[model samples]
Target: MSLSRQTTSRRRFLQGTAAAGAAAFVAPAANRAFALQSPNERPVFATIGLRNQGWGITNKSFKFADFAALADVDSNVLGANVEKAAAKQKKKPDAYKDYREILDRKDIDAVMIATPDHWHTKISVEAMYAGKDVYCEKPLTLTIAEGKLIEKVVKETGRVFQVGTMQRTESGQRFLQAIALVKAGRIGTVKKVTCGIGGMVASPVIPVAEVPKEIDWDFWLGPAPKVDYRALPEMRQGYGGGVPLYSNCHYSFRNWHEYSGGKLTDWGAHHVDIACWALGASDTGPSKITPLEYSLPVEYKDGNPVVHDQYNTATSFKIRVDMPNDVEMIINSAGDNGILFEGTEGRFFVNRGKIVGAPVEALKENPLPEGAIEEVYGGPVSENHTANFIDAMKSRKQPISDVWSHNRMLEICHLSNIAMRLDRELKWDPAKREIVGDDQANSFLSREDRKGYEINM
Candidate 1:
């Protein structure tokens, strides 16, 4: 649908459903069929990067978006996902090895970006400048400077952007309830928040191998430094299996510092974002980041890994972050994989599975005020992360996981990795968004893209 027509239809649907507010609170996903009304009113979408998460986000959004195109560097993966997506949506979408084709199509109202961490900023910025909304995966940018660039482009284009932090809107609304509890003073004067994001395992030296004929290796390595493709013969066996067990590509990209920030950005992106939101520090950031304990997979000198054949990110780590209001935030690879919030009056533990504590139990008798979750969410929460993105696209407003707030919290995760690599404590000036008096550490905030692939502003 055209942007103007989509907006008019959305407004009318929302007005007609105003009486269903009570039902919406019970099952927001059902009430969120506002975009499912007529064929001409449905929004158009296309997906970039058709790997595991690329397909995951696209599959869930099939109910709300009519996908028109799909792009990926791997021809095999691209072909497979296009068939699956077409079957689900009952329409065939054009396939392309290059994502720019999708961005150039004026009919595409928005683009869902699930590219590896390294490629996020380039594609997102270009898509916005091309006049399309964006729904990019979390750990929004590869570096702090990249995040700033994305935020700038979003403001300049006035496009709706959403990060794939579903915990804020989905997960049975467990995370939303947790935030509402904190706002209700159920956890009075929050003292500390712990985020156990888990860790990665060390990989043996992976031998350099010939690039797959079916994949465009150069395009896949866009912006990242040129390197020989490395892989192991033993194929990975489970959920994210079929790809090389230890390669500088596929799912293993998260284990490399060159492409991703290890577990710190992998899972920390989700948990730390929630921790910051509950503490009312989403707009600000930590004052200090200290790597209390860490174990790297390989030797390092001057913050750069000595070897390149194996994974180089930290295998295990425990970081301390000093937040506002004297809140001591701990991010570690131990304990439960969730956020544990403690306060002076009471405490609570929340993860994807459940939310439990004395305060959560007390909710049976002394419940929180009506519309508490909505207030914490800034407005009525949508069905899921993508639904929220579409809702924002219609209203021409920022989604719940806006770029400004996401970058603020993500700086903590990025700083944690920096502190671990340097093996020391680093002071931060949040307002300035820089490391205090440490030029070397500050240098890691941004990286130059490879020649011929720089972002086309």
Candidate 2:
């Protein structure tokens, strides 16, 4: 049968009552059965953390499969999402404050996790243990240790995991074609890669106020140190809130040390992952990180700038990381958020929707190495980011951004943060997964979980 005809047949079969049984019987051989099943036989997925980017991921997944449930700590966000999903799916979904409730249901074949960075490890590891595949948001973990832990669970459980670094799946022909060229060696020997990522600083702190009746403050604060809930008025800074609740929920989580690794991990999760991919260093990372310079943002406590927050994280900074084979990656906090690849033949730069070259027209004439980038990027090119997760779930194959690779890239982001914190150059042993010669810096690689929240190996 033709590909389109097979897709249609799968869709029809998936919509019927026997869809689950059909999927169970056919998924083991999904690639082979691709031509036989209707396109409707898509898998079912549940979404945890329904605020901010979580909402966008849900909409993307709906085109491929039924959105089985929505879970979140905030009732305000949860109820609104449930209604929206009901309208879209034509059925009210199960809603719960505790993600464990959703994980208990066998009907949920997979989960899309966009929780706070701290919670990413816990929820994802648990989901995999629960026999569910995961599509987790970027930065993957709150710390280097957690990244390694999640990587372990994923390997052992054999569950498919796709880090939500959607840039890997973006469709802009220029950027896609540029990365293709870099991998193809059109840029020649990659001597350096510079990534620029920064935006407005954290908002001034406000006093702690009553927790919204619609939100569960304790659950939202999951695993992080307890702090007074700040009632700062929401700022209008674009992508999610300019600041997250407790200064860690919204866009501002990039600024705090407790819940995130600031921009080092926030934007690093996106750009750095791509850089590593283009360099074919997904399984490894830079051998050394030196914080050339830094300027931290002012700290705020109870709506006032305190000395403590003066430089919680480096707001303006530059770090030079030494990759294998004498390749050096210079990352700077400047310009809009994007990456620039400086190669021997020429230099190529790419941000969200734009790609430009030093010679300007090199991109138009230089073709990618025959089957280079495509070989590394396995599977359908058109699958929406979330759809890739579902495809991996059924096929039990690694998605474009797997846990092992993402964790390796995350180490670069984590080490940068550590180097800035210590104000010193750091030596790293990737095989040992430790910072060499510095006990204090090495200690920062992991954190002590509050009692029951500790990650168990």
Candidate 3:
């Protein structure tokens, strides 16, 4: 069957089974498959950040395990998601405003954290320290130093951390087949890779406004320098309040630097990660990043074009990355948003919906060896990515997107932003994890946190 049809069929099956009651149908099969020592074996899960991507992650992960709790800063969004998860699991789950409360629960086995970028490292490291496994969303960290710190905590605690770069699981026929061909030398000595990530334009500035009563703006701005809540419009919009407010929570946070890493990090977390994976550099990354050119938007905050004001990230740029082994890759937001692998023999391009090759029919039929890509997985053929996480939780095995590899890939995305911001070429020592020669660029590796809300690691 086609991929979409197969996915639809699986969803229908799940819906039917859920409607018939999980105890009467789903639990028996799962118990038999797992060979439970006791009749009441269910993995208890909790979710932090209950809206947007967090809701989907919770619902999906809970399908294979028991959801024990839901936590979020906003009660409106949190209560709705808690109700939905309760109905799905056929039981009420504990709810909390602070994620620390969920981590304190001894009964919870793991947590799925989908908070904003700034909160990822703080909550993820704390969860590991508290003896619970973590599944955090992509980009993994707001700063390069944060990624290293989280990596250290995971090692110290021996906790299983699955970064939510689910594309590793969903590449399907096109991307999988393409990667296999590249690895098998069908592409010959691969010398260069082209990764395309788009940019964001500048946003018109507005005056600061009042903070919402529902939001603990202080806690929301945790670990970041204290800016009046009015500086954040996107978070204000998320509370059902309209725009034009200074501190709105809504759709535009991805463009700002304080809350997100812009397109370079957003799409870079997805596409550049694939580049790192296909090149077999998941455990390491590029050693040199040079910002070739950038189109700066016209806006002023304090004499510097405020790329962080509303949307201060580069809107158009190209960067060249020098990896180990003489491999040079170019990342740009100028072309289509996908990856192009150019080798000595032939080239292959893969994107969200399509994969194309110089030899056209190679991707359609007569693809790579049947078992080559699956060999990388070494697991049962399952469509549910969240199920893979729960299984890993029980087995104590690394999930498909393990922390070490995902963090290494994320370094490339983070550094790319730093290079663009500094507008210079940087020599990086990957082994030492430091920027060589440039003290200013190195300073961008970590941010100044607010006094009372710093990440103590």
Candidate 4:
């Protein structure tokens, strides 16, 4: 992480980004539409949602950009982050509970939105509209429609958007190496890829509790439909968790369908995204999704789960997806949690920690060319994901984890969850981006946003 020298003033930062936005959409990623300030002259940034990932990213953010302001609906977390930011350097950022206020600031060149899955798309779209570049955490959207909305926004605004699928720039480059090997035909014609992303567990019915005083409960539940506020265990920094209560607040939001698609989006957002990249199908999606076996925590009617008090996502499941070009893929709970890529010649498994298999073991004797892995990354390896985003901002280039491809990968995860919820097989047309002959299933492509929080392209 680079230390800030307080080089560029707030006023100059706003002027550069505003001038850049005027001609942003007119240029390509390879073209420089703005005159980027030098590394010594830091670009201004404001981080929204100072939770775990957001907190960690904010720490790394100072390396590349200035922290002009910080925002989170939780006032407790907001103040803590402001103190942490001030401790790192002399800059004292204004703090706010509403993230929109931070986005409204013209001096903010970019914002890292680490909000819950439900809020990712909305904040990202608004941030882009505010002429601020966005670095949003993964499972970038809650539904296919939201992905499309974000896609339209990114293309229209040409903002530097980087999804927090950081494995693409991990130190070992294990994922990139695996993708490179697959693309280089080191593994013969691709046969089938298995992504072992486990399902969510069933949580006992959680009783509603009074909202915390330090948090703005309404703002936190922005696009998600109204639900009773439940008290949750605070997640301590070093210790694992604060308590074992199961309710849709903070970290546990990942386990509920109302807020997120459970682990299908949690871990799936990472591995499945990598699986699609390896298959060279990032621009397209699966044509058919078959739920082989699944167990839900509750019963359902008309696709909405009947029991809402308990966790409703699938607790146990396996899904088979048929991608374009006859490639077979499975997202399930059967194996170790990682992506397994099998080709006619060799097979390998990769995750955030490691990439290993018979083909990889063979590398001890016959290694892949040095150029192969770098080619997968599109160039040399980056210092970190945040660095890549900042570099992209400077060069006006697309980051490794670009939006269109990530959204296409997310389509598969969303379809997998739909098939699991319905417990059936469904055919899809990636070209049309819809379920074929199944209106009910097609409707699952998007969800009804709360009255005031609809997303429009």
TM-score of each: 0.94, 0.86, 0.85, 0.90
lDDT of each: 0.87, 0.73, 0.72, 0.79
lDDT of 4 by residue, 292-394 (tens): 8888888988778987777787788888889867889988876788889998998888876788888889889988887887777776567577777866775
Model 4 TM-score on a 0 to 1 scale: 0.90
Mark the 10 consecutive residues where model 1 has the least summed lDDT: 1-10
User: Candidate 2 versus the native: TM-score?
Assistant: 0.86
Off by over 4 Å in 3: 1-39, 231-250, 298-309, 363-366
Better of 3 and 4 by lDDT: 4
* Per-residue lDDT value at 170 in model 1: 74
lDDT of 2: 0.73
Tens digits of per-residue lDDT, candidate 3, 1-457, equal 0112222322333344344343432342233222132324545678998667788777766546678899888777778888888788789998899888887676776789987788899888878877777899887888888888887887887677888887777656465556677788877988999998877666666456677666777777777667765454443444434433333243455665777777877888888878887788887777899988876554544323443345566678888999877888888988888889988988878888887877435545655667787665554434556766655555556887887787787787778778776667888888888889988778878887678876544
Clashes of each: 0, 16, 11, 0
Q: Give the better candidate number (1 or 2) by lDDT.
A: 1
* Arranged by lDDT, best first: 1, 4, 2, 3
lDDT by residue for model 2 (176-270), tens: 56667776677789998888877335445445566767778777777786765655555546566534333444545556777787788878888
Which pairs of residues collide in candidate 4?
A: none
Model 1: per-residue lDDT, tens digit, 20-92?
4455335554545445545555677899998888999999998888899999999999999999998998899
Q: Which runs in model 4 stand beyond 4 Å of their true positions?
A: 1-40, 232-240, 455-457
Flag regions of model 2 displaced more than 4 Å. Answer: 1-40, 171-175, 234-238, 241-248, 298-311, 358-360, 363-366, 369-373, 455-457
